[model samples]
Target: MDADKMSDLHEEGKNAINAPMLPIGTDIHPEDTLLEENAERIMLDPTSRENLKFKDLLKVLIDWINSELEEERIIVKDLEEDCYDGQVLQKLFEKLSGRKLNVAEVTQSEIGQKQKLQTVLEAVNELLRPHGWTIEWSVDSIHSKNLVAIVYLLVALAMHFQAPIRLPEHVSVQVVVVKKREGILQTALVTKELTSTTEMMLGRFERDAFDTLLDHAPDKLNVVKTSLITFVNKHLNKLNLEVTELESQFADGVYLVLLMGLLEDYFVPLYNFFLTPENFEQKVHNVAFAFELMQDGGLKKPKARPEDVVNLNLKSTLRVLYNLFTNYKNSE
Candidate 1:
């Protein structure tokens, strides 16, 4: 063969030997292709392979790249698994349903009252059933020649609490709605106040402390607010409380406290905290005070045996705190 043809054949041989198991997509850079091709050619040549030094060097490079790719795959698999998990699926369902159910905020022109309400209810029902929550809906009233409607939802909260032996009480959720003349709807949700344990733990904190933690929180305000409100709504009926302005503040406080605790327990030990020592203490104090407030209010008081509290893993609040802190530290 001519020189040029021989060179082309040699290149193709190298490409076949060094090509990744996965084909390169159209988006791959031309420069990367050239570099990879050159490296592969040098590694695959018969004379180069016989040279002990070159073979060892090529082996090391190949191993490093394979290791990195494997690690990335593992991480992606873990995240996918988490998204599929029941708890994660439920949270996503809540967020989507909550948005759809905001009757006052959603315009009739966008989605008719009935359609929006139906969608929200369906989403909630779908999620709840898998998590052992049975949902029941009832029409409260019909008005304007039955063109307008009102409905109520009762959700049975049956998730296993910290101790498998002692299950959480079944709670009821009530949602009220009034259809307007223009086919728009106004809605309100009511649930019982939190349990005595929750109230004691959450009520002890001064509102300002809760606000401070929220102000410094790492996540977006909307995200934090939504999560807090959802959590409160979930347990409100069990607690036997009406939703009020103070309840909003209390929910915010609970979220802030939980986020702070999460930060201390999970992220503080990470090497990243060393870079932000000054902020760490302030964050920790805010979390601890929040916990103290809850403890004082009798919200977080342990009902089971003293040791059960530790075993119960009632540290969800703490987990939130840690996630917030870690997210901020990582961002910095």
Candidate 2:
């Protein structure tokens, strides 16, 4: 083969490996020809627990955006795909801030889209700066349709605006970033938070105390269990039931449901749940039902999953009970 032809083939091989996976019709960088080098990435284990929680946060954010932009007839189903152009983001900023943004409503060229993103993000940062907060996203990240960075920006915006969304507090996701830095392939697994703030600081304090009790202070843990047992029995005594082991007694979720009913002064209908759960699925059903009841009573939704409670996960069970205890400790 001719020298120039051989060189062209070698470059094609290199570009194929480095090309980013972008949606069709999306414009690439101006300097790039067939592909953008060092733009390829792989998100490891998309179905992991942490990733599932991250997906939940994404859904909540999308729902919040759709609700806010309902008047504009803009429904955002995919944050990465829809918001990358900056049209939806511009409208969202205008809606939340109650101020008009001087940006184009539609931009086909990449430069115009990026300019719109720059303007919107700068305005957002201005509003967030007064509260000692700044967005962790950039125009490049948003334009690249980075889901994690987009989520962080939306969460900060929601918190600053008090958008009335039920954000999942204290949730983090493991992200695998693979990039070529200085001609070397580097892979890093990073755990990033999906949301945060003063509320999270308090939650972290509570979690750290629980860890300290669990790790360095068995006696203190036992005292907490005993106090919780006393609290449980105070309400369960009406049905001639008692809790001896905080972990095992709450495993099946029967006592948990009864305790919530007695604590909140509401009767859970027998038809709504199995009075005597005979199988694991039924136990999970009972626990899941109990959480719905908790929400209905205007209590904070527990971060613990129903299956975790059914399996007697100590940390998950403790988190649910502790949330209930803190809220009703002074009530009845």
Candidate 3:
């Protein structure tokens, strides 16, 4: 072959190979490069970068959510290990999510159990402060557990009172017993049988007189009993003799004086005598004389009225008296 022809063939072969092989950084044409550069510049601009940052933030948030789900799995495992049953776990989950559980949809047993557990926990917290006691309450059923807890607390308080603390006279402590019914709470200082009478008698007395009555020490049982007896008898006698006449005749001051006199003279000493029941009548007469003399000596005037002398409920009155007497006997 001629040299020029051979060289031409070689050049053709080289062109064929080189045509398929692109140079580094020259695969794109100049116009295409310019278009790409424009596209890149648009994408790299401030607004575009901000959009990219937002997209990245959203991805990060998604990842964080996934992580939280994983963490919840671990927490659930721990809860299971801790013996948190399904109902309790569900409640805890709802609480963590800031949502309310569909209690109505839940089984009655589960709802009851949860409520009972909550009540027991509250009771424990309440008793912990004053009694310095710790309780570990666990239950297969919440209602029974809670009822037991309430009974336990009452019994504990009763036991605490058996060895009563000597509180100062000025710092009076009123012992109010509480009972719960249908999720509602009720309180009474004494039994239900005595409640009406106690309330009636307490209401009839002035606030100061009522407070004075409450302040009497436990040592004055006889005085309290006698006073109550006399007060009841006086009202009964007055009611029986001339109910209509006395109702119209007595003034408020006269009623107050009569009540106060009965309390101070008959009640106070009677309470003292009752504390030592062996000398009950002697103490009653002696205190009655002192009371009369004090009134006659101008220390106190008759302040109660006939109108103030209302008829007492005999049944309620006797019931309260019985309670007082029973309490006295129990103390001895």
Winning model by lDDT: 2
TM-score of the candidate numbered 1? 0.22
Ranking of all predicted structures according to lDDT, beginning with the best and ending with the worst = 2, 3, 1
Q: Write the per-residue lDDT of candidate 2 for residues 180-275, one digit (tens) a residue.
A: 543434445667766654356334324445656776887888788877778778789988998888778888888888888898898888888878
Q: Which stretches of candidate 2 lie over 4 Å from their true place?
A: 1-136, 147-208, 276-285, 330-332
List candidate 3 segments past 4 Å from native. 1-112, 133-136, 139-221, 241-332
**What's the C-alpha lDDT at position 136 in model 1?**
36
lDDT of all predictions: 0.33, 0.76, 0.34
Candidate 2 Cα lDDT to native: 0.76
Model 3 poorest ten-residue lDDT run:
163-172
- Output the better candidate (1/2) by TM-score: 2
Model 2 TM-score?
Answer: 0.53
TM-score of 3: 0.22
**Rank order by TM-score, top first?**
2, 3, 1
Clash totals, every prediction: 30, 0, 21
Summarize candidate 1's per-residue lDDT along 1-332 as a digit string, tens digits. 89999987886676555433322121222332443211311011223224453333333323322332353332222221232212222333343344333334333342344444444446666655675443433111111111111111211221112211122222222222222222222222223221224323233433233344454754554465455444443434343533333222332233344333343343222332222224434444443445554454344422222222223232333343333433444421
lDDT string for model 3 (1-332, tens) is 99999987886575455434332222222322233221311011123223443334333323322333454543322221222223443433343345554443334575564664454445434544565543423343223322222223322332232211111111111223233333222333321111123233233434333234444544554455565555444543542522232222222123323333443343433332222223434433333343344455355321221111212322322332333333333221
Stretches of candidate 1 off by over 4 Å are 1-105, 108-111, 138-285, 288-332
Q: Give lDDT for model 3.
A: 0.34
Question: Is 1 or 2 the stronger prediction by lDDT?
Answer: 2
